[model samples]
Target: MSTSGGRPRRSRSTAVRRRPADRRQQILDAAARAFSEGGYHAVRLDQIADDAGISAAALYRHFPNKYALFCETTSGLAERLAVAIAGVESDQPDPRTELSELLATIATTAIDNRRTGGLYRWESQYLDRSDAEPVRSVVITQHRRMRTQLIRIRPELSRADADLITSAMTSVVASPATHRASLPIRDAQTLLRDVAAGLVDVELPVPRLEPPAPAGLAPSAKREIILAESISLFAARGFHDVTIEEIGAASGVPASGVYRHFSGKAAILEAAFWRASDRTTACITDALAVSSTPREAIVELVRRYVEVWCGNRDLIMVYASEIGHLEPDRRTALRRQQRINVEEWTTWVVRSRPELGAARARYLVHAALAAISDLVRLDRSSEPARIGPLAQRILLGA
Candidate 1:
């Protein structure tokens, strides 16, 4: 088929040709946004290519596979953060000023990369150890830098305390990535900086020594065993990746036995969620009952939350990451329960600080919770007592 003039009409292609370096950057930017929004397995190469305004073949020309692209995207993000604070000097005359400036830089970087910064939090689990290590190393280095400055400001802080506070502070600055809460850029930065700075003065509780495990273990019911195994598996590998058979095997039961104990994997997940919700509700009740004032209740609530998170890190991980895989009705119910819990905290927060309107109180509540949850998620050795005080500082603005 020819045009009316009997000559083939040349179609004008809308694609813009990019230099090699520019095209690579474009692909990485698109992939980072994609992976941050959708988890690793859910994102497709062709989709990223489309986002980058390139053909699939063109995408392949730069990166061999999606894994490579993902590694590059995440590593690039970590490197960007490292660069943001590279010039920060701990030798500055005023340690508080130095830390403040450092936090300001971090706040600005977090806001700038808010769209894609979440990949390191949620999707890094899918990365291989070799691919993940460099990214982790970069983050650890940044944390060390912040810790150094924090120690400089507070000379009395022990190495462990400095590390814990630094982790909490960084988590607060990075909290924007994990949620969709929006604020003006300047307001967001100031909020993060102020909250993080508050953590500097937080007095960590003395680290408690744990007693050794008992020599003998009491036998648990098969249902409890299955539930426990499923939570660990789901936390270690996401819900979608684990199978009923695998859960059964881990629990030393057959797949048929697992069905007898629970309906399926989703049922197990739902049970885990209910277990978490019930515990949280119990803590809230206990906190309110024992406290004489709203401030005391909030502090007690933070203590309880930190204890629960530290003891049940895997369970908290499952609760945070696997909510999307639950049945719609169950998911909605659990989410509603979460909102109720947050509302309780927000109420106490507003009562404790009437100057802070309900909206700002809720904002602080989320920031404090995110700071605690993320620190627990990232550090297995995080002590509850230490984290509890930092969380209190954030919430109480102490």
Candidate 2:
């Protein structure tokens, strides 16, 4: 603190200086973690700022609102995945080689960004059309490429079969997003790569021919349309965020018209929830009725489950995400139905794999469900023909 000629020395703060661009990048990274962990509607800007060790004002200086922040988060994720996939050389003469390389890359990317990479599972539906289109294009293009490679690797597999195989493979690689499990990056990459390769190499039996479309009368067209559109809107925006007026408009009806089919907004959600639950139960019941043995029953159950999932992804997605918003009676009813489905699967699993015991069988059944749900979670569902048999194979431990 002494200076020459008795001049006083000025004290300076010791904080390290970061460029604005570096700070902005830090904010984006923090936002990604927050959005992935808590979802778009649940997370607050100030919370993100706190996580980033910055002020809310500083956060806004970089991104105007939560919507913009989410758009950036999703766009960044899509860009990274696109770049990683693009680096994969798909023209290799050996199709499995190409698949192995792609799986390694995807697994590594997923592990490295484990906290954020899986946000699309629950958050992507909330994206606006303008933002969703680019992300969707990136994801779908990658899917198509994988499906093409799969078919090339196994020419005997039908296109639908290829789609399912590719979806299952991708789901295995992206499994970390939904769970809190941790693994060393190298370990995760190796395990996921092996699983994806194994999934790709399996030769599943041909699916039983699907029964004819039922001849029963359909639900009222207007009511069905209203429910369908409402589900879409609810999926894209959290249930609480969407208005009945908006749902009505999306369904091509007046706001008052929505009242005719359902009592109110919550009622629409209840109907959607019940419909998804009821249909899922029916699919399982019908599958069981036709299978002669426990093993056959399990396979048929998974096949029908995947069939239901692909045909009703939006509704199922909405149901999974918004069931908490339903009234207590409807929520309990739906959950009860869901438990029954799980119990049915558990019973069949125990009968088929006696060594697994009831507890292990139950866990595996949930795991199998997770495998199928994560595919939907990651937005990778393709043709039902493909997803169904693949899920059946996974569930049967083929």
Taking all chains together, each candidate's TM-score versus the true structure is: 0.83, 0.66
Candidate 1 lDDT, 20-102, residue by residue in tens: 76898999999998777655765789989999999999999999999899888888888888888886775788878888878
lDDT string for model 2 (1-398, tens) is 65897876666675465656688888889989877765666568898899888999988888889999988888999899999999998689887788888888887787778889756664456788887988988878787877877888778987656766787787777666654444556766776676567777676656557663564664669999898888888777678789989988988899999998899988887887777778878977898899999988987888788777766777766655565465557667766777778778878888887875665455445545666775664454244554555555545555
Candidate 2 least-lDDT 10 residues: 377-386
The residue ranges of model 2 lying beyond 4 angstroms of the native Cα positions read 1-22, 37-42, 122-134, 182-187, 201-241, 245-304, 307-312, 319-371, 374-386
Error of 2 at 10 (Å): 8.9
> Candidate 2: global Cα-lDDT?
0.74
Best by lDDT: 1
- Tell me the lDDT of model 2 at 345: 85
